[model samples]
Target chain A: MHSRTSFSVLIFILLIWEILVNLLHIPKFILPAPSLIIYTCFSQAPLLLENTLVTAVEILLGLMISLAISIPLAIVMFSFPSVDAAITPFLVISQAIPIFALAPLLVVWFGYGLLSKIIMATIVIFFPLTVSLHSGFKQVDPDYEVLFDLLDASFWKKMRFLYWPAALPSFFAGLKMAVAVATIGAVLGEWVGAQKGLGYLMIQMNARLRTDMLFAALVWLSAMGMGMWLLVGKLEKHFLFWLNDTKN
Target chain B: MLRVCDISKIYSDLAVFTNISFMVEKGSFAAFLGPSGCGKSTLFRVIAGIESSDSGHIEWEGLKLLNLKENTAMMLQKDLLLPWFDILDNVLIPIKTLKRDTKTGESEAKRLLSRFGLSGFEHYLPYQISGGMRQRAALVRTLLFDREIFLLDEPLSALDALTRQSLQKEILRIQLEFDKTVLMITHDIMEALMLADKIFLLSHLPMRIIKEIDLSNLPKPRYHLDFELAEMAENIFFTLKGELINA
Candidate 1:
């Protein structure tokens, strides 16, 4: 019921937008109708697909890099207080610093290639993953700690059996968050400096005043982000199957 | 024997309990009963070594238990089962924690689950089971921990009257059949009277064990009835009622 409402609301908004643009004779460059944007999507399919692939690569690579670093970092942060204390300030500074400013620096150091884009997305993705997972680890019931402490468990064994599974729901929450923001990082990187990507294509089209094509790029970019988010949701439902089972 | 000696806990200059001490003989069920917020739970935590007392020592089988001791299996009112884990896996938590072989623990967990009337629900989550069943699963987990002593913090108080009665029987079986020493903390005078070989009635804050009722002289399986049971229950009730009035 809720999803149906949302779908119809979206359709309603697009219809109003198309009609207003056409009825008012708005310039296509100034404000392309949704119909024109949809037309541009099919006409420039190959071009959009190529740049979509580039941005998609950046987002996926960034996501993988973030996951690789964050999961272990989260585990260590939970295991060792000293590590948590030492690493927290740097983590805060990383998030506090704007990605836009870092993008130029990233471009300068890693060049206007996929490396810089991937790194850009990693910077955007890392904090949420680590913080969410760390918070999840912290949220485990103290009763379970007594159980572990009584068993004379080593930190690794506890993390493997207890903390890891306990923290997964929140870790997936972080991953979904990362997937949503990852496009921003990838696109922003391309906007700052990139040889190829949807952001680069959008920038090029904007300069040429191809507003319909620009909107088409946006449609695809958003679709990619939405697709990734949905994928993460699917993965979460699959892996954290017990959460749903518990709700029943 | 599990012995707590000169145990005390003070918070911000207020005494939660002072010099509280008790002993439970091996294979005996001892209930530490007191009113709410009388620091009964704190004393239990001290014994379990989950919380450090202001000054105390707990000796289990002649070894001082400074931190968490492997000799005791503790359960709380909440089952504390990992909700994400199925019944069988939740029961194997101690096995997983001790880094023991799962292949062996799995079969043992199955046997125990079947014994506890959770035979077909091995794959069910905690929320899927009834509250009584969840607690029973937790009991199975505690048993699988396979410690010589069980530290229970109102482990069955959350259930309905019917379920609580049955679990009381289960606790008795654990002590009598398994021969594990049990030190349980509860507020219900009757619950203590029924299962505990000794019931230690506690005072209000700055709590002390004001009275220790020895039920060991009574016959096995007290059944929550009998003239002596009512008499002792009434005795402990008035004692706590007097304390409540005093407070």
Candidate 2:
């Protein structure tokens, strides 16, 4: 029902955009009609897909790298208060800075390669993942800890059985946020200095007065982001199946 | 036999138990009855070795229970069924957590759960079951620990009246059949009367065992409607009310 409403609203907006472009005599360089953008997307499918795949790789790799670093870091921070105390203020300070501002520096350090874009994506996705995971680990009810103690469950056993499961729903919540912003680092890095990706294509298309293709690039970028977000949601549903029945 | 000697706990400046003590004989049912939030749960926690007392010792038989976890199976008021686990897994958690052999866990769990009408729901999550059923599953999980003593912290207090009554019978049967020493905490007056061989009335803040009523020789299959039981419950209620009123 919600998707139907969104689809109808999109169609209505596209129809209005198409009509207004025609009536106002809007040139292609200024604002291409939605239909023209769609046409450009179809005509330039191979070029668009190639760039999209590059960006897609950067995004996935970025997500994987961030997951690797942030999850363990979150675990460490959760397990040791001294570590958490040392790192948490720094984490907060880092988040306070505008992450995009570091794109030029990242490109300079990692070069104009996939590494730069992947790092940028990782940066964009790291804080929320770490903070949410840490908080989830802390969410172990004191009572449940008592239960584990009564069972004489080892620290590793508690982590594997209790803490990990308790942390998952919140971790997935962080994952959703991470996936949503996972594209930011890749696209920004491409804009700063990259050989390939939809971000570079958009920049190039913008320079050559290819506004239609620019819009097409945007369509693909948003589609990638949405795809990732939906995939994370599906994974959460698969893993945290008990969440639905938990309210009882 | 379980002996709690000079057990006292205080949180900061607040006194929870000054020097509380009680005893439960082997193969007997004991209930600690008090008003809600009267530190009975805290006392159980201390007994289970999940928490420590400011001053005390708990002895099992003739030996000091340095590690209370090895001897006691506990069920909490909330069921504590680990919502993420299936009914069967929840039942087997103690064995797994204690690193016991799981080879025979499935059969034992199935048998216990079947006894509680939870057989078909083995794979179902706790949230999918009724509250009473989940509590029963929790009881089954506690039993699977294969311990001689059961420490139940108001295990049936969250259920409906009928469910509470039914579970009371189940607990009593389990105690008799397994020959387990069961120490339960409840605020319900008649419930203590119905189930326990001895009921200890408690008063908090330097918590004291205000009264200990021994019903070991009381007729079996005691019911709420019994004239003798009602009088006893009334007397206990007044004693609790008097404690509350005095404060």
Candidate 3:
């Protein structure tokens, strides 16, 4: 029933786009029809697929790096409050240096390759993950802390038994946000300076006034974002079934 | 045997208790009964060595217990079962924390869980079970370490009346079967009368034992003896009221 409703909505939206294009006599270069975009995707399938693969790798690598670094950093910060106090201001200031401005510097430092894109993606993804995980760690029940103390559990035991499990739901929440930003971060890095990637392809197509090709790249990017979102959602459901039932 | 000598606890400017002393036989059930915020729970924590007393000492079998291993297990009011852990794993937590060999502890854990009527629910998480089942799991966890003494901080208070009554019986049966010393803290006068061999009535805030009642002659199970136990309950209630008013 949901799929049927969504299909009908998609057709309705297409009809409206067609009507707007015809009534306003809008140039196709500015806004290509959905059908034209589809055709462009088929014709330039090979190049588009290649660039899409590159962007996907960049996003995935960035996400992996961010998870590796941020999760441990959160654990450290949680273990020692002073570490969190020291790192929080720097983490806050990092977000202020607009990605647009930092992208050029990243390319210059990392020399316009996968490293640069991955770095940008890491920067975009890590902050939310750190903050969310830290909050989750902080939110563990005080009763559990007392129980741990009574048992004389070591620091690692406390984290393994309580902190990790309590923080999982929030960690997944951060991952959802991280995945979306990771895709944008990769694209932004590619846009600044890159030989190959969806963002580069989009730039080239835009310069040549091939709006259909540009839109095709955009459609693929959106699909990638949605794909990552659905993947994480499935994982969260599989591992966190208890959380779902309890929440309801 | 455990002996507490002149133990006092003070928090900032407020004195929780002063010069409190008690002794528990090697295998017996003792209870501390009082109103809310009367320091019953605080005293329980101190006994468990989870909190420190401002002055005085605790000794077990001629060994000083200050900053020393007591081989004691505490069951809190809440189950404190990890949400991610199943019943069996929850029961095995103490074994794991104490770094006992898993092979030996696993079989022991299984035996105890089955004995406690939690055999089939071994793989079920805390949320999947009822409150009574969760408390049973908590008890099994507390027992897994083979601790000689058990500190129960109102372990069955969250259950419904019927479940609470059943658990009371279960706890008494386990205490008899294991021959372990039990120190329980509760506000329910009936509970203290039903299960405890001796009950200590405590005053509010800076709690001190004002009265001790011996219920060893009431009946095998005090809950079923309405006429006889009701009088004991009334006496305990009056004593508790007096303690509160005196404070």
Candidate 4:
């Protein structure tokens, strides 16, 4: 029932757009009708789909790389407090450099290719993952620490038996945020230097005063973000199913 | 057998307790009863080798126990069952971590779960069960370590009254059946009287064993010994209250 209501509301929004564009004589170059955007998407379906795939690949690779690096980094930081103390200031400084300022530098270093975009996404996505996971590791109950010590558990055993499980929920939360932001990071990186991505395609369409095509590219980007978000949600549900039973 | 000698703990120049000494004979049950903030839990941690005292020594069967391999299992006020683990997995945690090869211990855990009325809930996570059930699972986890000595720090204080009573009875049954030495800490004088063969009453702050009472003469089926136990509890309370007055 909620789905139906949302679908109707979306349709209603599109209908209003159509009426305003045709009856009010709004220029197509300024604000294209939803139908025109949909028609442009269909007509340029192959190019649009290819660019979408490139952007998706960049986001996925970047997110995977970030996860691989940051999770172990977090575990290391958690296991050794001095390491955390040493690296935390540098981590903060990394985030302090604006992505806009960093994007062109990344392109210069890595060139106008997937590498630069992937690097951008990694830089953008890693902070939250590391911070969230570190906080989760820090939040392990002292009582459980005592229990672990009493059991004569090894360091790895403590991490496996206690730290990992304690950090999972927070890690998933950070992953969700990373997924959403990763797409934007990929697009931003592409905007600065890439020759073949949805972001570049949108820029080309805008220069040609093809607003409908530009809007169509934007629709694809939004769809990709939502799709990745849903995938993360499904993974979270699959891994943390016990959370649901407890909530209810 | 476990023996603690002149164990004193201080933090940042403030003494938590000092010159505390006690011994637990193999297969005997000892309870520590004190008001809140008496550092009973800290003492338990010291005994379990989870913390170091400023000065003292602990021996388990003639082995110095400070920073040593803990042959003791400790249970806390709140059931610390890992939220992600099912009852069976939670119970098996210590064994899995310690890597002890003991099929007998595993079977003993299973038996204790069923005996304590957690028979069908083995696959359920800690949050899926009630407080009492979770505590029972924790007890089984502690037992699975095959420790000769069990240290319980207010293990049932979080339960509802009825559940607390039931679990207390269950613990007593397990103690008799397993014949393991048990050292428990509690603020409840009634619990001390009902379950303890010997009770140590502790003073506040720099806590020490102010009095020791023997309850071995008390009747079995603890509820039946209520009146006499209540009188003993009152005496404990009087001593504890007097300590507060002196402080």
The most accurate candidate by DockQ is: 4
Better of 3 and 4 by lDDT: 3
Top candidate by TM-score: 2
- Tell me the DockQ of each model, to 2 decimals: 0.70, 0.71, 0.58, 0.75
A-chain TM-score of every model: 0.97, 0.97, 0.95, 0.94
TM-score of chain B as predicted in candidate 1? 0.96
- Candidate 2 lDDT, A6-36, residue by residue in tens: 9999999999999999999999899999999
Q: In candidate 2, what are the lDDT values of residues B119-158, reduced to their tens digit?
A: 7999998888899999889888888888999988878878
Give the runs in model 4 whose Cα sits over 4 Å from its true position. Answer: A1-13, B62-64, B67-69, B102-106, B224-226
RMSD of each candidate relative to the true structure = 1.9, 1.5, 2.1, 2.0
Q: Tell me the deviation in Å of residue A111 in model 4.
A: 2.1
Q: Which pairs clash (backbone N, Cα, C closer than 3 Å) in model 1?
A: none
lDDT of 3 by residue, A57-120 (tens): 9989888899899989999999999999999999999998899999999999998789999899
Native contact fraction per model: 0.76, 0.69, 0.59, 0.83
Report how far off residue B188 is in candidate 1 (Å).
1.1
DockQ ranking from best candidate downward: 4, 2, 1, 3
Model 3: number of backbone collisions: 1
After best superposition, candidate 2 residue A210: deviation in angstroms? 1.3
**How does residue A56 of candidate 1 score in lDDT?**
99
After superposition, which runs of candidate 2 have C-alpha atoms over 4 Å from their true positions?
A: A245-248
Instruction: Give Cα distance to truth, residue A234, candidate 3, Å.
Output: 1.9
Question: Over the stretch B48-113, how does candidate 3's per-residue lDDT look in tens digits?
Answer: 777888998888888876622356788888999888888888888888888999999999999988
Which should have the higher DockQ, number 1 or number 4?
A: 4
